[model samples]
Target: MSDPVQLATARELAAAGSVRDTLLVGQRGGYAVRFKIGAGERTLVTKSGSPRLFTGIDAAARVLGGLGIARYRVDSSGLAEEDLPRRRRPDRAVALKRTHENAAYLEFLQQRAEAGRRDTVRYTDEQVNERMRTLRTGRRA
Candidate 1:
């Protein structure tokens, strides 16, 4: 097989009708586009020389459509639908729960502080300590 073609070159070839037939092949990560140019098949690759991958069939179709190539064959026999990677964020869920809990606790503490500020009564440190001792002992200080 000949070397893979970059997206720009592929687009030009597709627009010029040099790409006789297009095939969408399902790969490990995503769908790859293979073009039948002359008698050889060429895979679409990125500028970095890696096989270009599309997240889904629709995406690949849209790209091919933009290149003026419509009507392509899909070979999904290699695709393992269940094996596709899924987005998961268990850490994010735990972090969000902790964030909400912290916010609620902060609000509760703020309300208590505000109530204390609104009260006319005040006590010195020694008086407060004595009051705490009396409360602990269940006796007058």
Candidate 2:
């Protein structure tokens, strides 16, 4: 099993504030622990971690003792067939749970995805060198 995410104490995350949202990315592999403060209402998407990421974070915390920020824990003991039970959080079983809990975060992710998509353009091999040249050396390939 992959590593789990390092969970922080309520106090550790209280500073992020009720309105402020943040991503609890695992230091080693960037797996997300939870949606945290803001994870709802995304208009678009750029990059997203796999659904299994939560499971990995749980695995990670079990392997490593919170890595330095503070004390941490991820509950991994469930008798269900799936180590992680989705029914437990039926309301949030959807890949993206649109709610007050994750509003700001979803907006951030959508914006980044939209912006990145617009900024990047695909080109074929014949146009590759030309595009690279235009991007790097003015307007000539």
Candidate 3:
């Protein structure tokens, strides 16, 4: 989204290898790019014929191509959703596992909640306004 970030990413891709080796570029409804860096995966998407997106992509591709890192390509057939790696979904087992891991913290939170209810403070409207004024103006209301 940010120019610097996009450029940095392009540079990384360029450094990795040839564009043809690193990127799976396609064009269908729009432009789609799929690539992986380490274990992290990313996809860059731009609407077909979008001036801004095209300009940015072109610049990036030119820089990368000039550096001999990658080649950009456009294909009529786009990447299939099923071909992309699926994100891991946390199920009930995961929730239970996390709850078990945080058991002590959960108990502490429960205790704190009980204590908070027992120690509740009921302030007069003027007292509340005074506190708010102090917070706002950094002086006694």
Stretches of candidate 3 exceeding 4 Å from the true structure: 1-5, 16-20, 28-30, 44-63, 71-75, 79-141
> Model 1: residues >4 Å from true position, as ranges?
87-141
Summarize candidate 3's per-residue lDDT along 77-137 as a digit string, tens digits. Answer: 5545444443466797799889887997899999999998898688899999998888988
Clashing pairs in 3: 17-69, 18-69, 18-70, 19-70, 19-71
Residue 80 in model 2: lDDT:
29
Worst 10 residues of 1 by lDDT: 79-88
- Evaluated against the true structure, the overall lDDT of model 2 is 0.42
lDDT scores in order: 0.89, 0.42, 0.52
lDDT of model 2, residue 61: 51
Residue 95 shift from truth in candidate 2, angstroms = 42
**Number of the top-ranking candidate, with lDDT as the measure:** 1
- The sequence of per-residue lDDT tens digits that candidate 2 reaches over residues 15-100 is 45431333334323234343343544111111342322443554445423332323343333432234433436665656455565
Would you list the rank order by lDDT, best first?
1, 3, 2
By TM-score, how accurate is candidate 2?
0.19
Q: Comparing 1 and 2 by lDDT, which wins?
A: 1
Q: Model 3's lDDT to the true fold?
A: 0.52
Ten residues in a row with the worst lDDT in model 2?
A: 41-50
